[model samples]
Target chain A: MAAQTGESASTVLVCGEVRTCLLPTTQALDRRGAAQLLRLRADMYVRVSERPIMHVLSPETLTGVDCRLPASDGSRTRAVGTVIGRAALTEGRLLQTTSYFGLPAVGPDTRRPWGQYLVRPGIVEPFGMLPRKATAAGVLQGARRGELDTGTIAEGLAAQLCRHELLDRRAPFASAPTRLRWVALRTGGDRPAALTNFTLAEDGLRTVKLRLPPDVPASAAAGLCEDLALHDWLLTHVQRMLDDHPFDRADDSRSLAALRPAVTHLLHLWMPRAHVDGALAHLWDTLEAAPGFTRQWQNLVQRIRDQLTLLDLAQCRRAASSKGCEE
Target chain B: MPERVFRESTAEPRTRAVPLAHLSLELGHLYMEDFQLGPKRLGEHFAEVRIWADAVRARAARRVKRPRISTCFLIDDYFTRFSTPDEVIPTVLEEAGRAGLTIDYLARESGCAVADGVALAESVAHRLVESPPPGSYGFRPPASRTGWLTNGSRSPASPPRTDRGRTDWEPPVETAARNHSIFMDVELWSDDKNGQRVWSCSFLAAVWQLARLGLLRHLGEPVLVPREQDVAALPPDWDRLPPLIKVSATKAAFSAYRTCTLVPHHFLPVENAVRLVLDQVDVDTAALAQVAKRSADEGMPVPPEVAQRATYVFYEEPGDPIEDGKH
Candidate 1:
């Protein structure tokens, strides 16, 4: 295919038929030049042949043998195959190649025997054109080996391939600078997650500022607020547990068992015996009078009772410890 | 008693029509004279006619004792006046004969015996007076004083200024007809609310009652004679009344009144009610369409949530290649 195009270059034989020689822009034939070359080939073929003769031959057939032996030099006969191979290799190196997964080739003076063929691993003598599958595999393998950059791969595949497959896969992970500043504004100084290094004004409002990653779009701030709201509920519940048991010092690790003391302490502060009685009456009244309050009130009452039990146990332990210390 | 009556026999005529200027003087004399004249004058003048009517009614009622009676009449007074008496009366008699035959046929078909036709007619005529025809009792009240005042103030005073209080007053032709109909209605129904008479019969019933009472013979046909201006202003097809005349007329009058009076106070609620009704209807249609669209677009059976939330189904615009790329 490279020889037919009159440019020594690698070529793709699409659907085992038309030869498409791929040359660099500097060496490629312009439209008018290609048309002239096609006309010349037709004239030469018609004038040379008296009788029609067809041969099913591979590009390799053009090398390795000289049929007119006595009429040719013996040295020339030995060098024919090597000479042909060298010429073909030079052409392949000068040209570019492209791959088409399922497209047929088209060009003047091209013949296909079976219309389908597969490529195997090995250097085959350059036919009139390069096989489509072989060329694609070669470029893909080059990329995998880092012999070709992404740009080269893109150029080779540009004519017949889509870029989505290359783009859609996960890129190498890297952290970028944060773009948004987030501030957690709290009312008091004793908050567990407080940032106390900065001084507050006379109004006593404190804000703990944090940065959000650049990858997190501004639109996602709403989602962050929702997540923070859930986190706030959980954090409040945990702190309440820690407050209930004065002796049990727990760390920030959020385990249900560790949270029990805090929950109990908070419940005792929020609801003493008198308060609990009042809450129960209020809950009963609410459930009876307002249908909306029933489920929430039931959950609240259960939570309160559980915390009270834990607090009572903690108090007993403290009382026992005091007595033991006296003894 | 005979000698006392003889002594008073030479008394002067107690009642006489007075000139317009002496109306008050005449009325006072008549009132005193009537009080002294006793029951004899009352019986001879007013009570006698009523007694005669009661005697006729009692006789008719005694002759009929059926649980219910219905009668329809086609009085030919207008036909008699407009056409030859010979031509019109015979046609009416023929129609009445045909009606009687039809009723007999219906009674035979229903396996019922024929009752007295005169008694049925009398009872129906009496009931017709008691219950005024539809579209009778209602009167569109005078147009508001504010509208009259505004129109009066707005218009240039070239013509003699019309009384604002008389904006709704009809011309003599219309007023006379209306007053005559009112008088006949009062005489026919003889309605006494709290022993104070007020005619409340529907227009059609008054016409029917007048025909039954033989008043139409003395008064001529009671053509409705809509005001000339009103007739000119009527909407197209006003001459071709619909079968639901009563309903249509009441609706027209009520709508007019609503526009004049209730619009300011109740406009918002009425508009909201209409909007709400329309919205409910639209929502139902939209929901159905949405369910269908969802089923088609998703390529899955529609879920209940989709059906519940779907407001409308619309064809998606053809996918714009550029927009598809952006997404």
Candidate 2:
């Protein structure tokens, strides 16, 4: 009920019948002369036609009325009256009536023109043209589909609309901080503006400089670099293998066993000798303590032992063959 | 109740006594009566008598270092047939504690038979409990051109004793050194057939024996060598070996010993022999110095480069038919 004043607008206390009946004339003037007169009458009728209405229409409603000739015969004349009625106005039927007035004929078969009607309260502009509730819902639905609204500041408007119960006031987007922090650490760069910041650049190669923690050790930095490199290499290798083989059909247990040597090699490349040994020991202990790695661990152990034995035999055979050659 | 008296006896523990009878029984199974000559006379029957004698002495010294009194007995046959000096000394020291004798000195006295030496060592072991001599006991053969005399008195008058008088009754140091050299020669000779079947069989048998006796734990893993250059700058002990000596040794001892017999003419060139002898002397001194320096320079950790280089791959040929099929 509180009204806010706009630029160049005068303050006016509009209430009751006065507020309801005072339709702005500028809206009607937007149409053609005859259409404008009919629209004005329609708007006036609509304002006055409440169920227990107590307002009279002003005589100025008839000022812009005009006639159009029928095409059937020049002699034949039809009288068309643009009437303002309370019943028609209360139900928003005035809009159709105004649209009918703009047509050439006043017959049941004639089609009504759209946007021929003015909206009321005529004096006060209808409390700021609200975005339809359905429109707001549509915006949210579009956002969920990853279709961003570029033209309007919908996010801000949405935030305001959802400020009450729907959204968390404390952290509306709590995951954002963690996501940004991860980006900062992993990329060694400044936190980006938003997820959209990444999509803005065509190549997605915008590098932002970042300040690291003051106390980070050089060795630790080197180690992180090495680990990342190895991890990347291992990921590529896995991707390649997956691409080459029927990975979906392979048994998970067999696949994991096959990956062990590569994984171990990667881990060795990533860490120092002491760390590698400790990691291996930890892995062994974990595998022993947990039932998950039992099958794979046993298979690997047997394979390694068998390999060693085979190597020994091969060496013996080679020695024998070389001796025979000498003889 | 009367207070229990905790008596502290001044006398040494009786467990210190050597069970010579037990050792004699064990040795009886391995050697003939003639082979039972004392450590001093052992050189006559065995090529490298002095090395075994020294090993016994060293073993005795090590045992005495421990608080417990222990005696070690060496079977003459096993002692004489060892492939290397490294093998003999360590094995004797490890097993010494099991025998009842508290090893004191390992002496080699000429003229005494093995049985006589065993008796004399036992008597000396008994005396050790009463703070007796700690040197080894062995017999020395008489210096005369003739063999050992049956009668105690000789026809000729005794020669004038030298001023820095060492009696003929004591074993000479020169004899011990000469005996050690001979032992080394025998070890080398045995090692010459390393790649032959006999050598392999013997090596495996020795390994099995050591394993059964729980001595194999001390032997560690075998060092693998593939190329002559790998052991080119071996430690002082191995330096005496020629550039190709290690390769030849490994081939002869491990492979050829099992497959075929190689004559000296078949493998050892004159140039290789000369180079091997010179390199052996230099390498042995360097190795000894390096070991001493290693212990002294405890703060600076030695890199494992030397040990890693020592490892060789005996057979690194193309994949076998079975491997190709698997692929």
Candidate 3:
């Protein structure tokens, strides 16, 4: 463990990542099942709030880690601290876990008691002065074998929850899960919350790096990232469905087979920024302006709708012709 | 946001607070090996333990004018079933009296794993979050393979840790090492002949830390609540006994804001592993908040990290008149 100086206790570079996956049950959990499924700890009930969406938030949990800080310049500064993790269920269909922690500007020269690290639940104190720009770049670039990477922690947590006995080990659709690794480099209160970068990486991983005003807690960054990851997952999943049928009007059965899950499970799930806090909502705006998350989602939905329409007409003609023959 | 909001009873989250004390000081933990060594071991253990127990009480006194302090002892019945509690209780009490120590609560180690129809150990196991080694970029370590916890990235020690057929060996790297590594990987549990899994001594000690810290809850209620030990004679079997037995009248609660443990050097490694487990456990937020609030209100706040709330003094095992308790 890095010797925790007073400076590290008050963090400077706050970074974390969120991973989103499908609930493994054959059917999406109802409100009751969602609560039961997300009761990660036996002691506390899952936080189920109903308004925009019936959302469930599990109690926060911790994972301890000691590893080198991912410095862009390759200056080796080891860090030791606990990363905080929690799960959120959206409408009982999407399960997401955000595993995140932060590093302070500088730390004490010597390591202290482990209890000291536990007290700062989600904050991983760096051993020496932090290189904010380089470390953030390194984190965005992803871990290089031994650097501390929170996305794995987030994914690990989601995987653990998926294995719960409560889950039937069946998913309604066979869609790939995604991890959105995020970092919020704290630049003090003078600036507005601005997104630095959001990139779709290979192998079901997404990276988001941003700058936040001091007012927005690192958790807000996580919330924004979870929202992004969840919606991106929905898009990626539905896109795969559309990918199956390229409007080959002759092939009705295969198209319908592939598109059925998209309509049944995912179409209505597209309500972006439903749960993101107001402070960090603008980050979604940047994505909306550029490639536009909702635009791509709308296009995918249209493709699904267009294919389903073709399938609908094909079914109607067969019924009418059969009726005429009977007459 | 849309209209027609709905809320379910089970969905709302709540954390019922446990009775709190200023300090929860553990007198000692005695394993079967120590027990077989006989009453002489108990005398030496208690004699050495009494020294630090008083120092903790005095420290607590400075925090609160009359600190609500509770002292407890743990007997290992989980790893190996030994003499019946009927025989064990008398000797323990007798030895405690010899040291002028009044044990407020007597607990069984098995209870830390399960008590009162709750699978406490499994619940805790589900809560384990791996500490991220540096370069942890979103890739989760496979923790379940060996049921082990480590302070750093593991070396390619065994087939389970490294890929099959890869002969290249990698040194286990401690994330927080000054230079060279003091790598420690602890096995948390293994399956027995009946295929029922058994938690290792290190993992149980971690659970013991949570219990002592009063961070454990089962269905929003405290686990291992002390039952008054009115029955002078304990049951013939360990299974018949309640997990926690209160031995003497005291205003203090079993759970507290801080915990201090006195253990043998063998436990030094075990305690280190316990810290590894503890660093990642997400305790109930409401419980954490309550402790934070109370501690702040009392004008002596605790470290925000859960693991930091615990303290341990690892000394050489009982043999000679114990010199200044070793590290």
Q: Best candidate, DockQ-wise?
A: 3
lDDT of 2 by residue, A203-322 (tens): 211111111222222122222222222222333343343345443476544555544443433222222111111111232233234432345334444544454455557668988999
The C-alpha stretches of model 2 lying farther than 4 A from their native spots are A1-233, A240-327, B1-69, B79-327
DockQ score of each predicted structure, in the order shown: 0.00, 0.00, 0.28
Per-model TM-score of chain B: 0.17, 0.16, 0.88
In terms of lDDT, model 2 sits at: 0.22
Q: Give the lowest summed-lDDT range of ten residues in model 1 chain A.
A: A78-87
Candidate 1 global CA lDDT score: 0.22
- Pick out the ten consecutive residues of candidate 3 chain B with the lowest summed lDDT: B1-10
Looking at model 3, residue A136 earns an lDDT score of 85
Ranked by TM-score from best down, the candidates are 3, 2, 1
The top-ranked prediction according to lDDT is 3
Model 3 TM-score relative to the real fold: 0.74
Number of residue pairs clashing in candidate 2, backbone atoms closer than 3 angstroms, sequence gap of 3 or more or interchain: 62
| lDDT by residue for model 2 (B203-226), tens | 222222111111111111111111
Writing each residue's lDDT as its tens digit, candidate 3 over B220-287 gives 77787889876476799999999999888888999888988877777777787787788766565556
lDDT of 3 by residue, A1-327 (tens): 111113222777877777788888888888788877777666556677666677888766666666787877988887777777789999888899888787878887656555566555677777778887888888777777767877677777788789888789889778777878778777766777888788988999788878876656677677788888888898888887777656665477877778787777778788887777677787888999988989999998887787678789989999999999999
Lowest lDDT 10-residue stretch of candidate 1 chain B: B20-29
The top-ranked prediction according to TM-score is: 3
